[model samples]
Target: MGDLSLVRALGRGNIPVAVTTSERQSKVGFSRYCVAVVPTPSWVDDPEAALAAVIAWSEQQREPPVLFYQGDHDLLAASRGRERMAGHLRCVLPPAELVENLVDKQRFAAFAERRKLPVPLTRTLCRGK
Candidate 1:
């Protein structure tokens, strides 16, 4: 859903977009705004492989493309590999610590509390809890 919306929004501005999805059945690949649909390794299973796929695909492009991500996994994979993708891609990524804090609920809750952000208290439950 997010990919579809993003592609449509970009398309309105005549911006070309390419998508990388772990699922071959993703409908975003069929959107007219999508110029290319690349299959990437699942970020949930192996982030390193996903990042590698992103870099490899980016390298094959004629020019460095802006990296836009709607999913947390995509964001993390991109953030973790920002350095490696420097010349091959263009992206705005948060610092590693910030990315970690945002992606991890426990860390985000703690961070929010520390910053006096109005976030509800959060708890972590282990197995058998």
Candidate 2:
């Protein structure tokens, strides 16, 4: 959802957009605004290669592009690899500690509750239930 919204917005400004996805079959990557669609390694299966791909692409660009994080995985990856990536691109991601804290489900839930924020009820389901 965020990906499409961002892509369209960039399109409006006539910024060249490129995206990495599990495959070229990704509908979001096919938007008319998109100029390049690079299929990426699965984040779960090979995070290192995925990170490398992003860096490789950015380095090839004559002018560094503004990078956006699509989700927690992307955010965390960018945060962790910021130093390496920032050399070639303007990578935007929250601090690594902040990303780590927010991505931890239990910690996030507790923080939300402490701040009197609404939190959905969660239960740990047992195996074979």
Candidate 3:
């Protein structure tokens, strides 16, 4: 869904884009906005390897490209390994702490409540006590 949105938004603006995916089967590569597709390991499966692959992919470009992450795993890894990837690619990501807070929904709920953010009321029911 994110890929489709990106293709539509960027393609309409005539912005060049390249996509990367661990699964060669990913249909995002077929999008009209995609100029190229670089293959990389799934961050969830092998974070270190994926990070290496991404950095290498960036190095091949004459200029660093703005990265667009598709999921929590990619976002977290990007935030944690920002320095390494920063040398070769431009990325816009939340700080590590914010990523952690969001990734762990419990922390996010507490934060939202503290900040008085509008969120649906939630209940935690214990299985047994």
Candidate 4:
């Protein structure tokens, strides 16, 4: 859903966009809205396999496409496989380590503290407190 809006916005700015998904269900139908729809692999259990599938699929494209990974798992997997996927497509995501930190609340909090950035005070909840 968010990708569709992003693509529409990018289209408005005259930027080419391609949408990729693993699901058979179509969230956004192609009707002069975007460039193309590419189907990658689903990462329900094995994320590495999904990343490899996307990398292979991307490599077959005539032109290198700008890649935008939506899910965290996808982002992580893509980052891990970035070297192999670099020439095929450009991914707009941070490094794997950065993504890992972002996904982990504890790590993010520690990072903020180390960088002297403000972080919300959080408390652990206990049963029958």
> Evaluated with lDDT, which candidate comes out highest?
1
| Model 3 CA lDDT for position 100 | 89
Poorest lDDT segment (10 consecutive residues) of candidate 2: 38-47
Off by over 4 Å in 4: 124-129
Tens-place lDDT digits, model 2, residues 40-91: 7875577667878877887888887777777777776677778878678786
What are the models' TM-scores? 0.90, 0.79, 0.83, 0.76
Worst 10 residues of 4 by lDDT: 23-32
Predicted structure with the largest TM-score when compared to the true one: 1
Prediction-by-prediction clash tally: 0, 0, 0, 0
Of 1 and 3, the candidate ahead on TM-score is 1
Ranking by TM-score: 1, 3, 2, 4
Residue ranges of candidate 3 with Cα displaced over 4 Å: 124-128
Q: Supply candidate 4's per-residue lDDT for 92.
A: 76
TM-score between candidate 4 and the true structure: 0.76
Clashes of 1: 0
Q: lDDT per model, in order?
A: 0.84, 0.76, 0.80, 0.70
Candidate 1 vs 4: which has more lDDT: 1
Tens digit of per-residue lDDT, candidate 3, span 8-45: 68878998888777887778888878788778887888
Q: What lDDT, from 0 to 1, does candidate 3 have?
A: 0.80
